[model samples]
Target chain A: MSGLLSPGTKVRVRDDWPETRGPCHIRTPHYLRGAEGVVEKHLGAFPNPEDLAFARPASRLNLYHVRFVPQAIWPDAGGEALVVELYETWLEAA
Target chain B: MSEVLETPSDRLLAAVRQLLTDKGVVSREEISERIQATDAATPAQGARMVAKAWVDPAFRARMLADGAKAAEELGIPMRGMPPLGVLEDTAEEHNLVVCTLCSCYPRAVLGYPPFWFKSAAYRARAVRDPRGLLREFGTELPQAVKLRVVDSTADYRWMVLPLRPAGTEGWSEEQLAAVVREGDMIGVTFPKVS
Candidate 1:
């Protein structure tokens, strides 16, 4: 929970949304909020887009490529895997 | 003037452009130049890379390692843009890219995202039913092949390095590139030569 995660780490996207007002911008897609997946790769730290979108002084966040099963995301979906980039703060050990 | 500005967003954009020009933040010529640059970019840039990768092993290694650098190696300017990740379509795996939140495309290499790419249906169905979506485009994938739907949700953008078509074995890079289309790199269709 406190350390950086490596590739192949099992993680779950945090379902809770951050409270904001006045045109809140977020990179974490709503459909992936509660989905669980394996960390595919750790993309280098970049400025948090949520803050950057609002013209605020932003801090860098670790971005990870998380691969999830398509069937798990959609019950009748095909066998394709869905890979998404999520901020480190939004992921937890699954 | 009111007739020209049809919508609230159009009027807003016009106002912003005027304000920026008035404040000396950006010149009108610079704006036009940027639009020209955007327009000049096309899938040919990506096709160049894909064709080169198909024939050259070393270049393919570099491209897979660093997509932006590989693009610059081929004289495509990638400055001030998000990092690009090249998804290789292997014999057993096929790659598809989508942006569910917005149309975050590799504009530097592929020009603008197509109208369908930004549509609600494409965005939703690309993730929900990618096979069905591809079939509509005349692409049929067997169950054995692993399909990967990459959501360009953050800092990185993506493009597919499609599996080279079978008939084009001895084709030159230029010949290979001619067959590489936008949809081929988008994973909705395959690059074909006849």
Candidate 2:
């Protein structure tokens, strides 16, 4: 998970979730799904929380500080930016 | 006289504590010691760090680089917690922190979180409408300033390093810390000379 992504990488948050993904207990927010953002920082790796939430053996996932502009998340909003920490599993190479 | 009633969650917590004690998972004394440690921490610790950063350039550099280590240098204990990061607010950019999932805070430095921080309304609105939320907290930022809202949704806790107020030159570190408030470190409000 550490080497999967580096800082400053362009990523797109996955918009769709499969039914097999199980219950929605992941840390990645629903509003950020399908949003495009730049990886601001690599915030170290931690055990996959989706697995950990269910008491399963958790694998590590690369966590990143992704910065999204207001226009990307909310078209009518001002020119502010939102930085959300996301795991590797919720992101795709844009 | 009537007996006091216990909420379902409270009863559940009691049952869990009993089970843990029975299973030898944790002693009551250990739990009490952990609670005491958490109680001992306060916003003053964070304010002291901010004040030190304001007066000392080297400490500021270390604080901005690694918050957890910088806190340790100041004798703040951060046992069994996630890494800590300090976000610096500059003239160009203002930073705010929110945890939409849960209230993940740097309690080691800032003590217990305020009740509003854990409110569902705050968690939802902070990300959806940050400026409006800030306005509610009496913070009116200039339109030109870039607002950077940070969501603490991972294994890292964050605190804001507010810019030192003007006209406070030649002030001692203790004096500077007196002006730094908990809300300022949380980025909901700014520190003033008064």
TM-score versus the correct structure, for each prediction: 0.90, 0.89
Worst 10 residues of 2 chain A by lDDT: A17-26
lDDT of 2 at B170: 99
Candidate 1: DockQ?
0.81
- The sequence of per-residue lDDT tens digits that candidate 1 reaches over residues A1-94 is 4367888999999987764435678889988888999999888799988889889999889889999998887899874799999889889889
Winning candidate number (TM-score): 1
Task: Calculate the i-RMS of every candidate, to one decimal place.
Answer: 0.9, 1.6
lDDT of 1 by residue, B1-194 (tens): 35553899988989999999999999999888777778878999999999999999999999988899999999887767789889999999999999999999988889888899999999999999999999999999988999999999999989999999998989999999999999988889989878
Each prediction's DockQ? Answer: 0.81, 0.68
Clashing pairs in 1: none
Estimate, for each residue in B62-92, the C-alpha lDDT of model 2 and write its tens digit.
9999998899899887767689999999999
Clashing pairs in 2: none
